[model samples]
Target chain A: MTHEAKTVSEQTRERLLDAAREAFSQHGFQGATVREICRRAEANVAAVNYHFGNKDGLLAEALNFAPLKAMQLANAKADGNPEVRLRLFIRDFMLMLLDETNGSLPCRIMARELADPTPALDKIVREAIAPLHDFLGKLLREIAGGKTGEAELRRCMHSILGQCLYYRHSHPVLQRLHPKLRYDHKKIETIAEHIADFSLAGIGYISGKTCA
Target chain B: MTHEAKTVSEQTRERLLDAAREAFSQHGFQGATVREICRRAEANVAAVNYHFGNKDGLLAEALNFAPLKAMQLANAKADGNPEVRLRLFIRDFMLMLLDETNGSLPCRIMARELADPTPALDKIVREAIAPLHDFLGKLLREIAGGKTGEAELRRCMHSILGQCLYYRHSHPVLQRLHPKLRYDHKKIETIAEHIADFSLAGIGYISGKTCA
Candidate 1:
């Protein structure tokens, strides 16, 4: 295709992905309708089929697009102490979840997918999540004195990530239990600091080092 | 009014609740049909309306019933050292999630509700989850030497509970990450011990107590 044709096709693909992400996050995969997605994207009825082949294909692309973009942003600036790096990773993660313009669409979609997985999960794990997992694993190993077993490392990693992700995926339950807990930046910073301190302490304790 | 009539009514209600809980857990509130529930319960169509007023009422009751029963089971034999008690709490919570016969219905339903809450959430939190939260908070406080401030206590509690809950709500993701991590009794015990040790160390660290 010509350059102008390629640009138009790329723009339409982006629009479709944006619309599909919003729809899937709000209504979940099975509940989201292709017609509504097309309407929101202002694309032709056949656009999803032509560009992405189907709704599932569109969903896979959408889910991958949002988190990969956020992960790229979070992985930027890789020069700091492990603690500072951990803090920045968490702060960026929280910002991605609580972004006003997007409003946690990536997180919401991920949680939904985790709850009831689809064909997209395999690609998500390989492309979007596995690298992040490896990155966090390395940071955790360094924080734990660099000598823990793989199983031990995984458990520790889960402890840290579980804390961060719990706040996002379980927001409704947390709010129900604690009505005053806010989800704004200030609260997220506090949460990040607490998680970092708690995790560092846990790591220190596990690694036989003094935390404070 | 009549003694036999009361027994019969109770039996029917029990049957309806069991059937509705299974249906709702599998298909969610909107996707589950009253007809399917009635068919499973072996009850007439009017029986649900008669016993529970409507589908929503039946669902609320069903949701309440499952968790309350599990909570009661978990709360049994609560006399032990705080650490022992915490281990039991985590173990029982895992058991409830991995219950083979019921297959995590309570968890699935609860997750669905948290993802897209309805009016039932208010009652579920107040009636089912609040007591458990209070129970866990007390256990954590005792483990932390009973001197941490409320906010600190809450963050600690979230850390522990988040760890336990992550294994449940994110099982698919975890399984995808580590195909060898089983969810049987032995594996659950190891997880419980790890969480208890990790949490006690974290609490001690937070409270300025030397954990090791």
Candidate 2:
């Protein structure tokens, strides 16, 4: 294919991803229809098959694209201060969960997958979650400032992530339970800072170090 | 009705609740059929309407039963030591999550509700979860033992619950990530200790107290 043809194909694929993300978020995987996605994307029916092979392929890609991009952005700006890095990592994670444009599809999809896992779960875990875990794990180790066993390290990491993830996963229940809780970006910043402070204190006590 | 007739009716209701719990856990709210639950309970169709009024009523009751039992057990053994009480609370909550016989139906149902909420969620949160939150919030307050506001108390409570809950809500993802992580009673004890220690350290640091 010529350069112009290649550019057009790439644009079509991107449009399909955008449309699929919206449709899948609102209607879910099985509930979302390819015809509507194609119509919304302004692409031909053959475009999905040609680009992604099937709905499952598009589902995986659509679910992964934005969060992965957020991860990349977080990674690029990652720096030396473990505390600063932890806060930034959490802020980016909260952004991924509360991304306005995607309407939190990545997180909602992940929750659905957790309830009734799909084949796509493996790919998402390996591609997105595992790497994120490793990244956060290393940062905790630095802030901890001493030798910690695998189990202890993992427990600390889960505590931090669990706090961040709980807000998104339990947003509805939380809203009902505490009507004042909000998920806007400003509120998310406060939450991120709270989680960082709570996690660092726990880590400090565990590692026998004092952290600010 | 005679006393004997009332006993039989109570037995039937319990049996139906058991069946509905299993059905809803396996197949979800809409996917679980009244017929299948009846078949499993060895009761006739009219028995459901006669006892519970409808499937929605059965679902709310079934989802509430086991966790309520777990809470009752924990509450009976509750004492003044905030640390011990916290440990017991985490252990009992873990048991409620990993109870093999009930197959974690309450957690799964709650997850589904989080993903796609229904009217049942309101009742579940208000009736079941709010009390638990209040109970946990009090425990954290005791641990903090200072001028902690509602928000700080809640963040601590969530951090503790989040650690205990992570093992259940993300069981599949976690199992995939850590092959050796088990949920046996003995392991639950260790996990409860870890969470209690981690959480206490955080609370201590926040309260400006020295914690071991």
- Return the top candidate by DockQ: 2
TM-score of chain A of each: 0.81, 0.77
Q: Would you give me the overall lDDT of model 2?
A: 0.75
C-alpha TM-score for every candidate: 0.81, 0.82
Query: How far out, in Å, is residue B8 in model 2?
Result: 7.5
Model 1 chain A scores worst on lDDT over the 10 consecutive residues at A203-212
DockQ of each: 0.52, 0.52
lDDT of 2 by residue, B1-212 (tens): 66445687798898999898788766667667999999999999988998989988888778754565567456646787878887777777777677575466776566556645665988878766787787777777777775776777787887777777676667778888878966777777777777777888877776663222
Q: Residue-wise lDDT of candidate 1 within B1-212, one digit each (tens)?
A: 66445587798898899898788776677677899999998899999999989987898778754664566455555776887787778777766665555455666577566665666888767776677778778778777775577887888888887787777667777779888867777777777777777877777777773233
Which tens-of-lDDT digit does each residue in A31-88 have in candidate 2? 5789999999999988899999998988877775456556656665778677888878
Best by TM-score: 2
Full-model lDDT, candidate 1:
0.74
